[model samples]
Target: MSNLEIITESRFTTVFIIKMLYAFMCGAHLDSIINEIRELEKPSKNYKRMKPATKFIKQPLEGLWHKHYEQVGLKSMAMNIKQQMGLNNKQQKIFNNTFFKEFCDIFNNSEIPQDKRIEALGYLCSGKQYIDRINDGKLTGEWIIYHHCNGKNYYLNVGNHSDGDDALAQEIREIALFEFPFFKGSLPIFD
Candidate 1:
């Protein structure tokens, strides 16, 4: 097997290894999750928000869909798409750098089935359809039920939004607040 395949197969083990390395670098014990948390909490000016366009673009259906794929943890599936479509290195890098790590993290946390995860990722990566689904109010509530191109329903929930900066923006932001944790603590202003 290729190195990448081996690495992918041993994700849990790799996570453990990464934790061990982190602990060793910081002179800490392996059994202490709190220690890791404490170390992470130390203020660092290097932190920066992921750019929305770089992370979640507003145009080109493919770009948007890819972001959704990353959000839901389906890089392998996304990679398959890249291979099948003969994506160039630049495109591959975009998916690899931006969403691959995030996908791994989400996969580790979520208990959703693989097929369902793939379906959701597909919806997310399909930019035009994803926007349509969101704008059509199909992505609201505690769970999102997306109707795929083939007419099958796939269920998942990013969260709900209740307010925004304006009537419409506030409503959109409210939904975002619930569905996306990054927006949870943010203030919603209507003008």
Candidate 2:
């Protein structure tokens, strides 16, 4: 998990504790509040006794998880293809399958609405470094590009697909569309 995810989720933890503390200060049930405080102060047990129902539920599913560890569904299975990409005269190496899944997970978990989530993904992926790399070159965009490789980040106009070598450019365009759909609006670098 990223540090930002941890921080955002932790806001709830802070709010819960503060609410409990506020009730204590307001003198709402002195004995119950003191007992609650004591309960929290006590260290949690290192081991938990497994419930019988949990065992019964999981018994039949034991080996099922192992067979599907790398893939959860059809969409994920489709992304499992291995591919390499390069730009700026160097190889860029990030597993597109893994990266796409990560973005999908983030978008799925986020509170943002589904259609708007794509815009959020675009903004997140199009950080200054990616934009700057493209601005320094012949390419143009406010859009962000994630090569199947990580280091080969670049910027290109939305719908402009003349990257990579002759054979690889089409494949690169396909991967770019899969990963960087945020370039709905990309301005040229020169006028």
Candidate 3:
């Protein structure tokens, strides 16, 4: 088997892993969870103001998405985004970098099922539905998710808040989830 293939090891190595697995399966990645925790860590950031949500922008995002994807590490973009929101803070920026680094670790681990990875990638699309926060000045985070396109190189946001991303991952997952249910494999769209 290729080194990238998903191995058949038991995923329930720990309760936290189990919970994480279930949560990811249900449309939330560690990034989102981390971001949520970060929000809680700073109540002044309107701790309870945010809510999870899903949205669609039928218009293609090719322009700005690609621009941000190419310019610099997401950390810069994340900082720029936060700065624009007047919520720029040092601690949270650090969390974003760590979250992205961990995301890579999870992406590379063979023990993680490809379907699950696809599910994570699926965040780019939303069968399970990419869970995103509603009120946390995270509108800019959507762009950060582009770092995960089909195993392409991913760059972490350097500064530090834990919003590995917001809209970007959800938009991708939404697309993936939306497309997943209709696939017939080789069965043909109609026999």
Scored by lDDT, the top model is 3
Location of the lowest summed lDDT over 10 successive residues in candidate 3:
3-12
Off by over 4 Å in 1: 1-87, 111-116, 124-191
Who is ahead in TM-score, 1 or 2? 2
> Which digits, one per residue and each the tens of the lDDT, describe model 2 over residues 71-142?
123332222211111232233334345547657876887577777877767644544223333333222211
Candidate number with the higher lDDT (1 or 3): 3
Instruction: Tell me the tens digit of each residue's lDDT in model 1 across 48-90.
Output: 2111111112311111111011112244234433443344788
Error of 3 at 161 (Å): 24
TM-score of each: 0.18, 0.20, 0.22
Clashes of each: 19, 5, 28
User: At residue 115, what lDDT does model 3 achieve?
Assistant: 87
Ranking of all candidate structures by their TM-score, best first: 3, 2, 1
lDDT of 3 by residue, 63-175 (tens): 11211111224554444444433434674576556546656776897988988877674442222111232233333322221122232312211111232334333333344
Clashes of 3: 28
* Local lDDT at 71 for model 3: 20
